[model samples]
Target: MFEPIIPLVLFAIVATTTPGIATTLSTASGAQFGFRRSVPLLVGSAAGLATVTGAAAAGLAGLLLAVPSLQLAMKVIGSLYLVWLAIKIGRSGPPNLDVTMARPNSFLGGAGIQWMNPKGWAMGLGAAASFAALASGPMQLALLLGATFGLAAAASLSLWCVAGMLLARLLKTEWQWRALNIVLGLVLAASIVPMWRSA
Candidate 1:
C-alpha cells in the first residue's frame, strides 16, 4: 500500500505539470484576463480535475473506459469543446471590452476547457487506476490519490497562470496581446495530440 505512494506522487506531479488542458487554459486565461482575474477559473478547474481524479480512483473512469461507445462519445465531446475554445480565443478581439479587478469569463472558460480535456481525463483516470491497484483500502487510496493530485494540480496551474500574466505584462501592447491570443490558440490546438495518440 505504502509502496505506491512514491509512484503516485510522481505521477501526480508529472501529470499536473505536463502541458495539457489545464496548463494551456491557465496560461491563456492569464494572458487574456490576468492572474488576479483568473482565480475563479483556477478554482473551478481544480474542482473539476479533482472530481475527475476522484472518479478515476473510485473506478468510475474504468466504467467509462469499459463502454467503448460511451468512451468514444466522451472523446468526441471533449475534442469538439477544445476546438471550440481555440476558435473562440482566436476570434476574440482586443481587450477593448473592460479591464477591472474582477475575474473574467476566461476563468470559467479555463475550467470548461479542462472539463473537456482528454489529457486531463487520461491523467486523472490513469493515476486512480494505477494507484488503486496498489492500495489495500479504498478510502485510503482515494485520499492519497486525491490529495496528491489536487495539490499538484493547484500548484502547477498557478505557475501557468502566473507565467501567462507575466508574459502578457511583459509584452504590454495591444499587438502583443493579440499575438498572445494566437499563441494560446496554437497551444489549445496542440492539446489534441495526446487524444489522438490515445486513440
Candidate 2:
C-alpha cells in the first residue's frame, strides 16, 4: 500500500521545484514584496498545487486525455496569460530606494496562476499517471497527492523566493535589474513549450 508513496513524494518535489512559471512568479513576488509579505502568494500557490493534484487524481487527467480540444484550449489560454505576465515582468522598473515597488499579485493571483499554469497541469497529470496506486480510492488518491504536492511546493518555492530576495540586494543599478527582469521573463515565457508537449 505504502510502496508507491516514496516515488510519489520524490516526483512531487521535482514537479514543484523545477524552474517554471510558478517559481518565476514567486521570485518576482519575493523581489518586490520580500519573504514576509510574499507569504500569502506562497500559501496561495500551495493551495493551488493541492487543487491541481487533487483534481487530476479525481479523473481530470483522463478527461483531458479524451478531449484534445479541451487540452488545446487550456494550452492557449495558459500560454497567453504567461506571455502577458512575462511582459509585465520585463516592463517593471528598478526598485526605488525610498519607495516600495508595486505589489502586482497576491493570494488570489497566486492561486489563479497555478490554475492557468500549463506546467502545473502537466505535473498533476503526470502524478495521476504514475502514482495512482498510492491510495485506495479516488478520494484517497486526491487527498494524498494534494497533501504531498502542496507541502513539497511550499518548501521548494520558498527557496526560490528567498533567492530572489537575496538577488534584490545586489541589484542596485537599473541595468542589473533590467537584465535580470528580461532573463526571468524570457524563461517564464519559454516554459510553455515543454508544458505544451506534456499536456
Candidate 3:
C-alpha cells in the first residue's frame, strides 16, 4: 500500500507544479486582488481538481479517451473559454485592487474553470495511466490520487500567485501595469497547447 506512495508523490508534485491554465489564473487573481482575497480561487480550484483527479483515477479518463469526438469538443470549448478569459484579463485595469474595479472571480467561477480544463483532465489521465499500484487492490486509489494532486496543485498555484503579486509591485505606472497584464494574458492564451496536444 505504502510502496507506491513515494513515486506517486513525486509524480503528483512534478505534474501539478508545471505552469498551466490554473497557475495563470491564480497569478492574475493574486495580482489583481490581494493574496488573502484570492483564497477562494485557490480553494475552489483545488476542490475541482481533486474531484476530477479522483474520478479519472476511477476510470473516467478511459471513457473520454475512447471518444474522439467528445475529446475534440471539449478541447474546442475549453480553448475558447480560455481565450475569453485572456481577453478579460488583458482588458482589465491595473493591479491596484481598487474598490471601484469589478469583482474578482468567485469560488464558483474558479470551480467552473477547472471543470472544462483539458490540461487538468490530461494530468488526471496521466496519473491514472502511470501508477499501476494506484489500483492494485486497496480500493483507495481514487482518494489517494485526489488528495495528492489537490495539495500539490494548490502549492504550485500559490507560488505563481505570489510571483504575480510581486511582479505587480514593479509596475510603476498605468502603462507598465497594462503591459504586464497583456503579457500575462498572452501567456495564458498560449498555454492552451495542452488542450490540443493532450492524448
Q: How many residue pairs clash per model?
A: 0, 0, 0
Cα lDDT tens digits for candidate 1, 38-111: 78778777766776666565674445535535555555665566577567666654443223324455445655
Q: What are the models' TM-scores?
A: 0.56, 0.63, 0.61
Give, for candidate 1, the lowest lDDT window spanning 10 residues: 94-103
TM-score of 3: 0.61
Residue by residue across 56-114, what tens digits does model 3's lDDT show? 76674345445535545555664566577567767765543322326667777777777
List lDDT for all candidates, in order: 0.62, 0.70, 0.66
Error of 2 at 3 (Å): 5.2
The candidate with the higher TM-score, 1 or 3, is 3
Global lDDT for candidate 2?
A: 0.70
Sorted by lDDT (best first), the order is 2, 3, 1
lDDT of 2 by residue, 85-180 (tens): 667767765534332447746788778878888777766765665454455666777888889989999998898788777866777778887786
Clashing pairs in 1: none
